[model samples]
Target: MASSKSVLHIITELGRGGAEHMLYKLLSAMDGNLANHHVLSLGSGGPYAEKIRALGIPVHELGMRMGRPNPMLLLRLRGLVRKLNPDLVHGWMYHGILAARLAAQGRPVVAGIRHSIYKLSSEKFATRLVIRAVASLSPSLAALTYNAHLSLDQHRNIGFSSKKACVIPNGFDPDRLRPDPKVGARLRAELGVQPDVFVVLHAARFHPMKDHKGLLQAIARIKDRNMVFLLAGTQVDSGNPALSGIQDDRVYLLGERDDIADLMTAADCLVNSSWSEAFPNVLGEAMACGLPAIATDVGESAAVLGGTGLVVPPRDPEALAKALVQMKDMPQEQRIDLGKRARQRVIETFSLSKVASDYLASIKMFWMPTAGDGPKDVQEKEFLVHVRNRGVYQLAGRSGWGRADFAHHDRCGAPSWPR
Candidate 1:
């Protein structure tokens, strides 16, 4: 196997957001002898900071706050980038993407576009502005990657080029998250949930876009007393003022948890009430844990469910309530079978190892150009190669492989392939 290359990942924050959590999963999946990765966050360190350090991935914080533009942030980031000089700079989210572009300094930058724009109203004005700026500068990147197909088209429809876009769907680790009945039973007992109770999980931060209120409304409409809602994520606890108003005794609040896989395993079903999303990380995680999910028809969620669960339109509590009830009343054996199918689908198509490898395959070549590239548009790569005197060989862009530059040979009889 080829040796791992160094990559510096830049993100807006190390917070427990969808994008951040997905980045963590990617790092964890790609970690080992074959992956050398570091992290840089534009904002203060978050929950993932400790885990990242545990993985031996160095983390750098720039102390940039949202809703404000600090010019000094650009200089600091650039300084760090120049100092580290990684093989490629991979930026996550909009702000990170823009910073990566500015700090690339001739290195190939990979900008990750992780979300779809459902409406301008949902975004802060400053965030919207930064997104607009990133849109214009997006073409400067070696490749702009999107996890969801909807996001790629949503941006491309507004001016970004489809040609420059790459799709690498999020990956889940079955080894890390698999069905565990013992853990599930213990978790239920610890939570005081009855064995006969039907547990539904909603694992996401308390954001307006997550439609927490809508989910609450749907649950309120459900008359089944055996139904218990397990809300887990940032600010989903009793101390949160918004959630404190929820007086339903059946609702169990678990603020931020590290053992989401265990929670998913204990749950009878996973429900997503987000108004908009990129790829629905919670749904994917739940699937990896062998739990069926019910998600709104947003982003690529409906496609991801793959007939294993229910799908309802966003912002419709009645539909969601109906879906929840439908899932609850399912035959015991049938639900178990559905859960098995969900796990199988994720393992076959969205395993974290496979997804991590795919991401590496797509971005690895950006820094190291292989031999036999036809024509090189990038002038800096014009160094020549001699593969046993095969008529002055250069990397060729044949069949769309864009990095072929060879006019002079410094090392003759080197391997035909650029190591």
Candidate 2:
């Protein structure tokens, strides 16, 4: 039966942030186009709006001015909510969470907390105000979900409610992200990286939070001249003054490219130097693409790795350099084995279908209204671990990972992951 329930997603913006990517993935991965989905962004929808629209979903932008609150945003959001009358409203990040809470009007509203509260000082003043606001107002929301277990605890320490909090890790499509030899070759050729070079990919915008300088120091320590660093993200190119110290001939700056999945294909490793994160998707993405990773010990990074890659302390360039050398020195067979395990970890635990099922289950737990039955059906049919010990990963024609409906995998049956 077509579910009567529709979900409205509210976010600060539909930029390329991890939260936006996850939201897009969630809606796209819904089985049978399950629940009717709509999105409202407080700012311009940005590049991702078109991608989400391509999925037959509608996206609304409130044109809210960033770095400052727009009081009228509430009025616009309230009107939109009344018109759409969604069965549930889900908010992403602090700004969107409070806005959703204000507009829900006693209806079921769930908030998503995607950033790690590593320290209160890490938050901007505007966001700090929202965090404080939510501290008192979170109880009104039906439930709150943290992308990382660490984020949940950190927020609780800062006086956010723990009474109705849960963790739902981000999900990925192994099929879409797995290693492609041809794609990798094409990417390397396009980037002018030599066939013999050991390529390490770093993806993050030019922000102090990313600690790009730490990574540059680590790269300097790597003795191999054949080593190449492919830097991506907004303003991560040589023209950025922050990267002026990077005089290595092998350093290739790709300011911002949409085909990150293709770049992941060509990468020998993915490095994340973020000082704080909730659930950094780049490491998981690299793993999904069958590449080893070296990431700082930020929010859920080590956890996300699942022993599939190396994790070092944040802001430690020496340790990161050592890890790089270790990776470069490892035998190709051993590295390949690690890469295989990395891919397996993503497939087993973080596949888009599995995480989507968990999300749907959480929604069911929060609100039991009969109107919200579409995702409930998906949770039962596609994400089941076992089928009478026949040993399969997902049901035929409903895996929810991609357009393909009948893909299956062989593995011992486990609750969250069978294969």
Candidate 3:
């Protein structure tokens, strides 16, 4: 038996968002015999820290905060990376990519680009700078995995390395997220929602990008008193001042929830109103629960639906309202059939086990061979071998993986194949 390789995952934070949840789900689905995993958060560890720890994986925190960059953390990160000496360093987002590039110290580093970029100027000044920097440094990376094909195309258009880019959409576990009428009934009873009332779910953190205001406006356009919208995520409760003036009797603000699967089971349909997204995890989770969805045509949303649900233009409240009405007015049997097909789509296309295996395969491509097994001189060289088109390209140069040397080596020789 071969020894399990080490993988270090660095993310912007450990918050309860799509990226965070995906990381947790991926870790749970991955085969432990192949690799040992460790997670490092550039910012404070949020809800996911303990959840990840529960799986027996070590989680480290840098104690950084939003809009605040700490230079001292670089030294700490570098020291930690050196200490871990992981076979692969996987950065989860733009900030994590920046940190990974800065601290990898000639180690192989792969990046996860999780968001969509429609326009560069629309981004904050700081974020724009980071994007430019990441783009400039992208050419030498061993690999760049995107959660959506749309995100990969958008980033590549903005100068990200197309050669190293690949798409790996988000995955869902049907067993954990499937429909349960009993659980749905229990949830509705607890929430005081009548069995006949129509429930529309929008589960995402309260952020400008999520466009909670747009969702609220769309719900307001509807006159159906029996229809209620359930908003669930971090800071998405009644206490949020931004939502105060618009929220009404028909709107239920559910603060951060661990029982989203139950909520999905209870809801009649899911709505994703975000103007931007790479691959919204909640949509798939809702689908896995056998709930139909209505979403904006953003970042693989329509593709995920695969003709199973409704798709509308982004930031269009009237269209959203119309879709809501359309979904609500559909015959119960037809809607239930759609929900069943949606669940089947998730099972056949986005099973967590299959996606986790893809992730593991991508990671292993850059895992270096044991030192003595490779040629002595080649073992001493600090570089990552990227296999593309049957050729091996050196991914890391002297200072960083900022330059690539397209030199193919015999697969049977030293550093024959990545372990």
Candidate 4:
């Protein structure tokens, strides 16, 4: 067997967000026989660091100061790269991509674009310069969603060919998520919600892009008194202050709980009103837990849902309210069927195994054999000869054959094949 390859993955932080969660999933699902992995966080470690560390993968917290660029940070990163000497450097998100590309020099760098173009701009010229620099320096870049790939084209316009830029969707582990009736009951009871009350859940950080205000306005427009909205996610003070008022009897703002899977199960439906998204993981998680979703038709939402959920136009609370009402009146059997289809779609197309394989295949392609490395036919013959010499073919038939008596021995010695 060939020696295992080393890959270093760099990310902004180990935060509890979609990109961070996907990074953890990818690292955990990586084939140990193929590569040894290491992770570095350019920003401070958060909730995800512990879980990543628990996976026996080395996690480094670079203790980077937020909101300011330090030249020494790049030097430190380069030092890490020199010490680790990874065969490949995989960067996630913007800052991580910038730092990793600079540190990798001319080494193979895979930059992961996770968000939309609307989210890429910065008022600071330095940040934009860094982004452009990274885009120029990266030998190859990968987008987590098709929208992200489009976003890259619209914004940075990094002229890398299609072969150098590919789309690799996010994936989820169905087993890590399960529907817990007790969790739903406990959350409902804690919020003083009646047993019969219908809950619409929105689990996302209180960011301006998430459009929580629009969701709240839609819920306020609902005429039904029995309907409650469960808002669970981190609350950022930087976002619109008006969203803070959403905390009321009908709208419960549960800030950043670890039991999101349980909350998805507890809710009548999962709601997403994001102004933009590359590929929201909440929709996949909700579907995996057999919960129907209602989302704004933004950033591959419709594609991800695949008719398993309802979609409304962004920033339209009236339409959102109408959809909510429609979903509320939907037959229980039909809703369950939709949820099953959602889960099945995720299983078939977005499982962690599938995503990992796609990434591995892409990486292999990125490292294509150079001239004088031998042709495909020669490589195949060499591989077969190695297997045969190792006695792997003895089990192919009931009886083992002598080396000279093996079929196609002459073919192995042909000029087209490697010696």
The lDDT leader among the candidates is 3
List the candidate 4 regions with Cα displacement exceeding 4 Å. 1-3, 119-127, 138-149, 152-163, 236-241, 365-419
lDDT of 2 by residue, 1-419 (tens): 76667889999898878888898998888853456789999998588888999988899999998777767878888999999998789999888888899998766778898988777986788878889998789766666777765677688778776655656678899988989989999989988887888988999878887888898888888778878988899888878987766778877888888988899888888899989887888888899999999889887787677677788999999999999888888888888888999899888778898878767655544334335566444333323321212222221121212211223322311122221
Clash list (residue pairs), candidate 2? 397-405
**Poorly placed runs, candidate 2 (over 4 Å):** 365-367, 370-419
Best by TM-score: 3
Better model by TM-score: candidate 1 vs candidate 3: 3
Candidate 3 ranges with C-alpha deviation above 4 Å: 368-419
Candidate 1 lDDT over 1-419, as tens digits, reads 63457788999998787788788888877745665788999998788877788777899999988877788888888898888888789989988988888888887787888899977556888888888888788667767778765777688766564434555677888888899999999999999999999999999888888999999999999999998999998899989999898889999989989888899989999999998997888888899888999999998887777788899999999999999999999898988898898888888777888778767666655655656663233312322111122221121221111122333323321222231
Worst 10 residues of 3 by lDDT: 394-403
lDDT of model number 1: 0.79
Residues 245-350 of candidate 4 have per-residue lDDT tens digits of 5445777767778888888877889999998887899988998888899999776677778789999999999999999998888988898898888888788767
**Rank by TM-score (best first):** 3, 1, 2, 4
Query: Which lDDT value does model 3 have at 278?
Result: 79
As a whole number from 0 to 100, the lDDT of residue 341 in candidate 3 is 93
Per-structure clash totals for the candidates: 7, 1, 0, 0
At residue 332, candidate 3 shows an lDDT of 98
Please give me the total number of clashing residue pairs in predicted model 1: 7
